[model samples]
Target: MRETRTMRPRAAPNRLIAAAGLLTATMTTVATAQLLPGVPASPREKGPDELARMSLLPERVGIPVGGSAWVLVRLAIEPKWHVYWRNPGDSGVPVELKWTLPAGISAGEIRWPRPEVFRTPYEITYGYADEVGLLVELKASEEIGTGARSASIRGDWMICKEMCLIGGADRTFEIEVSGAVEADATDSDRVPITDSEAFAAIARWQAQVPVAPPEKMKLRQMVEFPNGFRADANENAGVLRLSGPAGRFSEVRFLPDATPGTTYPEGGPVEGRVASGRFEVEVPISVRPGDALGEALRAAGIVCLGNARTDPAFEIEVPIGPPTAGGSTAP
Candidate 1:
């Protein structure tokens, strides 16, 4: 089976610009829905006349073998509203990404730009309050020997604001494998993205919540949850249970290992590095109810295909998480 994960390689900051341009290509709402056949209509999300509708784009993009590819998502947002980053800080949704690939092709994890801090008298949050694009790296399958051919990628994601709404759909874009290219990414094809624009935008957002220089003890680490988490699992549903040395580090937040806030911010912002170590918390499971237990263990929060796959290497990603494997079958 193809690698079902955010497999795109990480790029240097300058390449970050190119990836942002290419991936941002699909950020805003595209009038034409990149929907799969038979998928029901997603209620139209409102946007200002000046704001062209955009869709939620995935940073985990793909390319054809022997050719270059960029993956993205488009978020069609309403006027004066925005979505959350991985570190949503107290409240806000995270953009979860999943990719479908053919043999020999590969994709990268989402490369998030810096996010702004939304502070009200009452609470502090992290995210993009307006439309923006996510960027990723996709390389073609060298195995597809030089020739005229095509490769396809499917992306699924969610877009939300103050009120939460989950939109699940698959959109596939094709790439040509011929020595001569037949199509070039442009505003007409989807949307045009520029490196400068992305940098400026991110820089501006960063200004809103710039962290001070790191302490001498700066560090970074991830504490993964056990496999059996759930909405109402053994301990407070799917919330991660923390203990031991981190017991007193009670203040908890979920942010990406790199970019602090865009992808999974559930607490406050911590620079890409931390110090004086000990951390712990109970994290939530984004997996829906009635999902197969094994598959649930797989996709719950991070949408990696590994989240769906177990040791047997059996294939079982059924759009939404699958039902229990080899258990009493549901009629």
Candidate 2:
């Protein structure tokens, strides 16, 4: 595997135009923050946990015998405040989770919901405002004893508005261990699920999590070095082309996962508007040579449909190959 990389799409029109759009967004956010009552005037004006609260919501009352269940780490943020996403973009700390579980029970990675793009005068960040649900699946071993068990979790995050504050909370709960039940088992024989509202809420957030793009939507990537591989300056750039069902979407955008050694520069071309069911965007990449290149210079990120953060989003990882000798450019 190669170092983590930053993937940001140079917005449409041009750099100046994109900057103007971003500036407008920044201003709007600032204005919204100002309008919110009780917002901190300075970064250190309030207590660390004053802006955000955390809770855990398990989907089922029990981890089914030899099966798994999902639990959500929910964040409730104050007005105009937000918590970072996995790739926090220019600056911000993402939410971190630590779980203490009984033996034979393991937790899976967090299933992040599609994030909202936030722009400041100097940088861009991805995060969720108001509230968000991050799903973590817990699996129980088939040979484990059947009884009740205690599970605990701690969530740490940096909540932000005009400024930022680090916050954390710990929660513990009980889970029943039920024996395997037959397929035809009556409702009483099976472990019950959480309340309907809670169950539906979890499902709604699950739908926001990015997954593999469907086969029908063709997605592709390619790299081009305008200065012919300037390792010294870290000047590497590329393009992405995607196809979708006719009229199914009006626009597309890409948000790269954080890679250790890669940087996405500003002032790159923008090409994400859908034209005749095709979407394309130029992603500015800066790769430090002697680090890694070739097939290892891969890009992984979320492909969001529509401008709204809650809209449908898909995940993609594409190899970075040199531009074909006579490679065709997106029209």
Best-fitting candidate, scored by lDDT:
2
lDDT of 1: 0.37
Residue 4 lDDT (model 2): 14
Q: Give the TM-score of candidate 2.
A: 0.73
Query: TM-scores, in order shown?
Result: 0.39, 0.73
Residue-by-residue lDDT tens digits, candidate 2, 277-328: 7676666666564456433555567778787656777776655444445542
lDDT of 1 by residue, 136-237 (tens): 555565465332223333333333344344443344443333221223324222222224443344344333332321344222222233354233443312
RMSD of each: 14.3, 14.8
**Poorly placed runs, candidate 2 (over 4 Å):** 1-46, 181-192, 221-237, 267-271, 289-297, 320-331
